[model samples]
Target: METIEKRKWSVNSVLLVLLFTLFGAFAVFPIVTLIIASFKPAQELMRFGLNLKIDPALFSFKNYAYLFTGESLYLTWYWNSLLISAVFTVLCLLLSSMVGYGLAVYQFRFRNLVFVLVLVMTMIPIEIIILPLYKLSITLNLINSMWGIILPFVVAPLPIFFFRQYASGLPRDFLDAARVDGCTELGTFFRIMMPLMAPAFSSMAILQALFSWNNFLWPLIVLRTNEQLTIPIGLATLLTPYGNNFDMLIAGAVLAILPILAVFLFFQKYFIEGMTAGGVKG
Candidate 1:
């Protein structure tokens, strides 16, 4: 019976390894394809399209060279994206987390109603309210500016909801203890409670960063100048009616993935913990 159990355990272990290998391959395939395509010349890409196979003789750094040295404005787009995403992520985390912590810990009239409004806002798509957002941006003279894009999404509803759920799981004793130690209401939240919610902040930071990085439609509407365009919008302009810069486009996309990957790796330790801790309360 012991020998049979050992065999069963070995079989299960093998199956789990195989399953995870398959999933890893599935996730890595597209990224591998993109990297390979970046090396190939534009003519080759136009002719053969994207394929996994690499030919060392055919691949070169010409695309990347052109991206950096040429008058393509690629680096401008990269810088713009980095700046906007960084600022947006920091602001969203601060504003949303505070709103969430307030809803979670404090008692006030219309607290539940405000939370319900956040939930309803999450259910609504950006496509639905973009018209109003555009009008508001125009009214505030934020058109053709980074602030237009950043301000509209700074207090994202989803992050607020997530933070609120996560904060709910935090002990009220921490708040009381901080108050007893002479911390003011704002001081307790900023100095005491905020540190305890590191995992939640890390998770939301990654999320909000990705959203700002990949945001295309809103940036497209707001930013008109070439230098002001984010990476997504700038990369899109490469496919104009006059020319199709497949080489630069593909290489730029691969380069763009680096920052996002770095952010994830940096905050990875807290990601799963944050999700699970918050989810338990909800």
Candidate 2:
């Protein structure tokens, strides 16, 4: 019996090790390769992938250094992305959380209809709206403006749906108890309910921030000036007809990805809680 138990334990340990090894090869290895490749000279980049063999002597920080030089636009792209993503995230959270909390807590006429409508809006294809949105932006004389890009994304329906779903998991008795203690409707929400929903906010913030930061297509339609371009668009601008500038392109890609990676890693715990709260059972 003891011998059988020991064999079961050994099997489980081996299985865990195999899972780790597989992910290390597929996920961790690619990131590690990219980090190493960023230091490699342009002469070695094409061959700097995960399985490639090369001398460590061929690696240098010149690629990163050149991209970070005073004349380079890398910092500008980073700054724009950070500012826009932060603003968009907060706005989306506030709007979605308010609407979601209202729907979750209140029973009003047309309440179910409104929730269904919001859910329906989430199903609308983003591509279908591109042309009409561009036309509307033109009519409103918002061409070449950051508002043209920011304003449209501000009405995020999916965030509303996600927040509403999360709100459903919260205890309704908390709101009733708050009211019994003389709390106003808005006060109960602001002080009690919103605080309880932090995990959901963190999850939505991570996702919305990533979307806003990496937003490419809408920016392409609305932003004409290089100065107003977001990170994704800015990175694409590096690919010009004059020459591709492989080293600079790779450098820019590395620079662009780091912040999003950092944000995800930072809020990973909250993301898990939010996903679990929303009933994924993760």
Candidate 3:
């Protein structure tokens, strides 16, 4: 019996090691390649091929420097992307939270039907509606403006689902207790629920912020002006007329992804909890 138990423990340990080993090779390798690529010069980068090369002498910071220089316009992209994503994320938080609260807390007519619709909307890709949406934005005179990007993002279904799931897990008695103290429905939501909901709220905001920040296609189709472009578009502009200038391109990619990486690293624990909130609930 003891021998059999030992064999089981050994098997589990080996499986665990293999799982991490596989994940690291796929996930860590690409990011490591990107970070290492940022330091290589143009000629050296070409010799290294697609994968990241490991060489002490081949490294240079020129890619990073060139990225920030006035000629690059990276800072303009940075600021514009930051502002647009921030505004869109804040709007999503407010809208998703309100909608989620209504669905999870209120006893309403057609509630399940409305929620099913929202769930269905989540499965639909944004690509299908882009053409008509673009035409509508053009007719509304919002083309090439930040609104071109921000307006459509206001109703993303996942954030609403995330907020609803987390809100559902909270104790309903607290909401009832607030009502007993003469709080209006609006008052209870803003005063009691909003404060308690901050952990999940921040997590969802981070997710939406990253999505909006990394959003490429919508801004690419709608934004035509150089000054109006977001970082993803701006970085994409770095692609040479001939071919990708791999060093500069990767540098811009690094810059584009770093802010959200920082945010995730800081708030990761709460993010995981929010994601798992709906797994086993009544």
Candidate 4:
């Protein structure tokens, strides 16, 4: 019986490994193709298109050089994206966490109704309300500004819901203890509870950062100036009726993913920890 069980466990482990390997390949194939294509010149990319097989003669750093040293405004676009993403992520986490904490910890009337509203907001797709959002931005005179991109969705409902869930798991004893020790409500949150919620912060930080970094359509609508354009919009400009700069476009896309990779690598451990912690609490 023991030997049979051991054999069964070994087979299951092998199957799990195989499944993960397949999933990883599926997710990574496009990224790998893009990176390889970024090294090829526009003429080569146009003629050959993408392939798994690589040729040493076809690969060059000219596209990278053009991005950095050439007259192209790739660096400006990169800076714009990084700045917007960073600001949006920080503000989102701060505001959303506060709102979440209030909903979870406080016993104010209409709390459940407010949370239901947040849930409903999350269910609604942004595409449905984008026109109203654009009109609001125009009315507020926020168009063509970086704040225009950052403000509308900075305190997003998803993060609020996530934080509320995570905050629910926290011990009420800590709150009581802090109150007895003469800590103000804000002081307890910032000085004590906030430290204990590190996993939630890290998880939300990574997600909000990635969303802000990749946001395209809203920014494109709001920002009319080339100087204010984010990475995605800037890359889109590479393709026009007049011509296409495939090399630079691919290279820019490849580089654009680096910040997201960095954010995930930094917070990946906390991301799993936060999700599990919240899940177990409920």
In terms of TM-score, the best-performing candidate is 4
**TM-score per candidate:** 0.89, 0.85, 0.87, 0.89
The candidate that achieves the highest lDDT relative to the unseen native structure: 1
RMSD of each: 3.2, 3.6, 3.5, 3.1
lDDT of 4 by residue, 1-282 (tens): 867766555787899989999999999998998899998887877887776768898778988989997488899999999899889989999999999999999999999999999979878889998899999999999999999999989878877888888898999999999999999999999999889888789877776777788988999899898888899999998989999989789999999997667756777886565445434545
In order, candidate lDDTs are 0.88, 0.79, 0.83, 0.86
Q: Give candidate 2's whole-model lDDT.
A: 0.79
TM-score of 3: 0.87
Residue runs of model 4 more than 4 Å from their true location after superposition: 1-23, 271-281
Per-residue alpha-carbon lDDT of candidate 1 for residues 230-249, written as tens digits (9 for 90 to 100): 99999998889988989889
TM-score of 1: 0.89
* Runs off by more than 4 Å, candidate 3: 1-12, 50-54, 273-282
Going through the candidates in the order shown, the clash numbers are: 0, 0, 0, 0
Would you list the clashing residue pairs of candidate 3?
none
* Residue-by-residue lDDT tens digits, candidate 3, 1-282: 867766555787899989999998998788888888788776766776556566788777888898778887778888999899889988889988999988999888999999999978977888999999999999988899998789887877877787788788899888999999999999999999989899878777777787788888999998998988998888787786888767678888887778778887999986676556445353
lDDT rank order: 1, 4, 3, 2
